[model samples]
Target: MERAAEAAREGNAQYFLNLGDDELIKLCQKRDEDGRSLLHSAVVGGNMHLVQLLVERCGNERINSQDSEGWTPLTSAVSCGFEEIVKYLLSLGADPNSTNAQNRTPLHYAASKGRVPIIKLLIEAGAKTNTKDIAGWLPLHRAASAGRAEALRELLLHTSKPLINARDISGSTPLLLAASGGHQAAAVLLAAKGADVEAEDKDGQTPLGAAAPHGQLRDALVALATGEKTLDDFEN
Candidate 1:
């Protein structure tokens, strides 16, 4: 299996092709000692051609089949922000909500990377915005914590009525996460969406309090101070 993977990495398309359907099935079905498959190899290679071929031969259910790390082929594609590969996987009915060992969905990957197109694609496909990971962090929480302004915007546009003030298991709302990360744009957006800038968590830290120490949070502070209108009002 490592040899086949190395072959793919070295661009030995012919060797991969010659591995035979029977052999390919064996490898794709036979989890390595590491629990990885030939499909996993194709995904790691990010070879769109190989991925398509693997899908055509192995089918979509196998496309999501995971290795030891619980990473599906779609997970690999999204992690690298491979837009077309992700699209193809989704077209084949790949599970948008599938979580790895960390409990992160593909939306989380796109949000964390600030990949707008992929983020939009996932949202349009009905990816849940509020899915929690092992850390109880949702895609919104990740976008806020990572300061991914564009990702947050795409999400807001899609989820017009999203729980802007919904707290994670840590009791941190999107506003608090954004402010804590010093993401002015995200914080402002959250506040404008009716995030309770003054809402305190178990620790008694408001979004405003979270932003207090960060100079970059000034615009967000002002937005929170003055943004009294409901976030839903801004929806088109």
Candidate 2:
């Protein structure tokens, strides 16, 4: 099993080829100490050829298999911004909405990293835009919190009607999260998209109120809350 994992990490295609058909099958079925299959190792290593070989042998059932962390190979690929690997995994029938232990899908990973191409692929592959993680954070929440302005824009454009002001477990809307994270661009985008800049979190802190102390764009946030300057003004 260790050899198989090592082969995957090194992208050693001939190692599997040298083994008999049944032996290769057994190797493909093996999991590492961390409960990750050869497919997981391949994806993690960004070894596209190894990934292709493993998927060809093990099929889509293995593609959707989760590791100890509940992360599918698709999720792993997405998190690392491996665009080609993500596309290949999806082509092999990997579920775009497959979740990790935190219930964060590939879209959440892509959104967090601002991987717009990967996000588009996942959405096109039927990932629900409003899907929530264990923390009740939607992909928009992740994008906003990470200050992924382009990813946020892509998400809003893809969804039929995004919950612009949807609250998470902490009662923090996307706007509040952006403001709390000091992500001025994201905050401005959310506000322009009709997020309630005045909406409070569980602590009753408005976006402006929450951002005042630590936010780099405190003045911009203040103007946004007061409607003194609109998103269009910033865009222009």
Candidate 3:
């Protein structure tokens, strides 16, 4: 098992290159103490050849198999920001909505890392943009809080207006998260996308209130909130 993991992780195909079919099956069946299979390590290693070899030679059941952390190959690829691997997995029927231990999907990870192209691929592959994690944070919330403006825009392209104003379990909207995180660009983008700036969190703080510590951000949100200015004003 260790040897298999090592080969998969280091992109060393020699370990499995000449192995017999039965040997390959036994190796693929074994998991590390962490419950990660060779496929998991192969995805983490970013070796497309190994991935193809395993999935094609073995079977598809392991494609969505979760380790102890509940991560599938699709989830791992998205986490590592490997577009080609993600695309390959999706093309081979990997679930776009696969979730990990935190109930966070591939879209959630892509949004947080600001993987714009990956974000588009995941959404196009049928990833749900509004699915919440364990914290009730949606992909939109993740992008906004992480200040991923382009990723957020990609998500917005598939979101409904009601979802645009959706709040998390903490009652924080994407705009509120952006403002609290001092992401002026994200805050502006959210507002322009129809986010309710007047929306409040559990603390009774609106987006403008959340941006109070950042003078420029606060003023920008305030102007947009009151219709005194538009994002176009700044962009123009």
Candidate 4:
């Protein structure tokens, strides 16, 4: 099994390709202590050939199979920025909305990590933008918290105004999350897209109030909040 794992890692396609289907299935079904299948290893290792070979042999169920952490091969690909691998997996019927132990989807990881390309692939694959994780945080919240502007822009386009302003369990809206995290660009973008800058969280903290810490270009954000200026106007 270790040798097979190494073969997958090293892109030794012929080694596995030569094995009979029965032998291959037996080899692929073996999991590590964490319950991660050979498919998981292929994805994580970024070996597209091995991934294709394994998925073709192992079939759809195995391709979408989750490990103990509930992460599918698609999840691993998204996390690792393996765009081509992610595309191939989705094309082969891998679930785009697969969640992990935290109930976070591949979209959540793509948004949080600023994977603009991956974000496109996931959303086009029909990944839901509003799906909340254990913390009641959506992909928007994750993108804002991470200060991912381009990814945030893509999300803003597809999300409705209300969901753009939607609050998480801790009462942090995307704007508040962006501001508090010192993401000036993201906060402005959220505000321009109809997020209420004055909307308070459960703790009565608004985006402006939360942004008090970073103190970056305060006037610009304040002007944006009050409708005196829009982020788009600034660029124009």
Best model per TM-score: 3
| Candidate 4 residue-wise lDDT, 55-148, digit = tens | 7887767878888999988998999999999999999888888889999999999999999999998889999998899998999999999999
State each model's CA lDDT, in order.
0.77, 0.86, 0.88, 0.86
Measured on C-alpha atoms, candidate 3 has an lDDT of 0.88
TM-score of each: 0.88, 0.92, 0.96, 0.93
Worst lDDT 10-window in candidate 2: 214-223
Model 1 TM-score relative to the real fold: 0.88
| The candidate that achieves the highest lDDT relative to the unseen native structure | 3
lDDT per residue (tens digit) for residues 128-171 in model 3: 98799988899999999999988888888888878887888889
| lDDT value, residue 3 of candidate 4 | 80
Q: Over the stretch 56-101, how does candidate 2's per-residue lDDT look in tens digits?
A: 7766578888889998889999998999999998987899988889
Ranking by TM-score: 3, 4, 2, 1
> Which pairs of residues collide in model 1?
none
lDDT of 1 by residue, 1-236 (tens): 77877765554567767777888767667666667777666666777888777667666668678878888877888888779888888888878989999999999889888999998777777787777888877787888889887788888776646577777877888889989888877787777766778878889888888888886475446645685443454343
Model 2 C-alpha lDDT versus the unseen true structure: 0.86
Question: How many clashing residue pairs appear in each of the predictions shown?
Answer: 0, 0, 0, 0
Would you give me the overall lDDT of model 1? 0.77
